[model samples]
Target: MKKIALLALLLFLAAIGLFLAVVWNGYEWHQKLTVTMDTPNGPLSASSVQQMRLSDKRGPWNPPEGSGVSFTLSGEAVVMELAPGRYLFALLTGVPSLGRLLHPKMDVIDAAKLLERGEAEAYRSVTLSRRDYPLLVTFGDMNDPASVQRVDPANLEASFGPGYRLQSMTLALTEEPVNTGRVKKVLAWIGPHPELKLSPPTGRTSNIPFSRRVGEGDFIRGKT
Candidate 1:
């Protein structure tokens, strides 16, 4: 009870702080940053920088888009205002200067299955805007895009960590043939958290050992 009360107070304080920042800071605080994919040889949208993820035709996965664009806060430029929701950085233009996204036709679903039955090792790798804190990622496929399926955070909090919503998901990039096992291994390498709470597509879920599911809503649309 004491812990719960303290947690509630903290949440309330955070909400108030965010509201103040939004009101006082205005768009200036959240003004989007723009950069070019020098190799792209074209123009692009500034929004992708905080929303872009390089993946197959399905979208949103490892390696991230815009290899030439701002990779993260520490990349081409620095990020000033950080938020709690999901963000991606792209090379203004989706197309990487004439270069194309690899494995544009691969299926994230199949890649996930391989990761499940211990047959695949595919994973998504990308940099983050904030370089200070270790970022937490919740792997999502078709079956459980949110990963948690809106069950209870208590079920996942131990593995994915707390205060982290869905930031982004990683998908396979090789189409001709994807070594799911290998991909998972790669994702595990860049992934700050090794113990993944893999929630298979069968509606069942499992925690990697270091995650905790604190509640039901832990599986927010983006966080799950």
Candidate 2:
């Protein structure tokens, strides 16, 4: 009886080990990518970054908990050994020049205060898909048509305040893939939530005719 019991225990342990191995194999496919920058500031490190995982079938993955790739940045280079899945990467620096179009009145500093005041600021997002191995990504000053349009001296000065100029930095991947269905889902989600929309203060503006009259019927009614 003792011998039989011991053998049964061993079999149970072996079954568990095999199950774990299969699960790891199914979930652990990863590839390595190298990223660099041309500016003197050097490579981006862990200090200023945000990352998200992507699903080939569903789009971006929002795990209830944390589940993503790991990377290391050295000087102007970054090496990411991410699971063989899609991912989004963002590097943080100073204010993005073209971001002015989104919130003309808000500077990065002012945006930060809005956070402190329990408000929110929206940031611009761009996506690129990479399908090849040994991938390399480069970052430097932005000169793209969209960036150029937003940063034109006249536009920036008008929107971002007098004398303000727009200077932008950007990222580029060597092997960009066409927009995948998954990327569209991710973009749809990056927009500001409805709750974040702030209503303008209730008051008269210069544009309103001084002759206009206020009426109680114009106000929203409450349930009796």
lDDT of each: 0.26, 0.26
- The TM-score that candidate 1 achieves is 0.16
lDDT of 2 by residue, 50-154 (tens): 121121122143343433322212111122212123121221111122222234586533433332233323322322222111122211112211111111222
RMSD of each: 23.5, 21.5
Judged by whole-model lDDT over C-alpha atoms, candidate 1 comes out at 0.26
Cα deviation at 106, candidate 2, in Å, is: 48
User: Highest TM-score, which number?
Assistant: 2
Candidate 1 lDDT, 6-99, residue by residue in tens: 9999999999896554433211001122321111222222221121122222223223342122211111111111123221222121112101
Q: Which stretches of candidate 1 lie over 4 Å from their true place?
A: 1-48, 51-134, 146-224
Residue 84 lDDT in model 1? 31
Candidate 2 weakest ten by summed lDDT: 215-224
Could you tell me every candidate's TM-score relative to the true structure?
0.16, 0.21
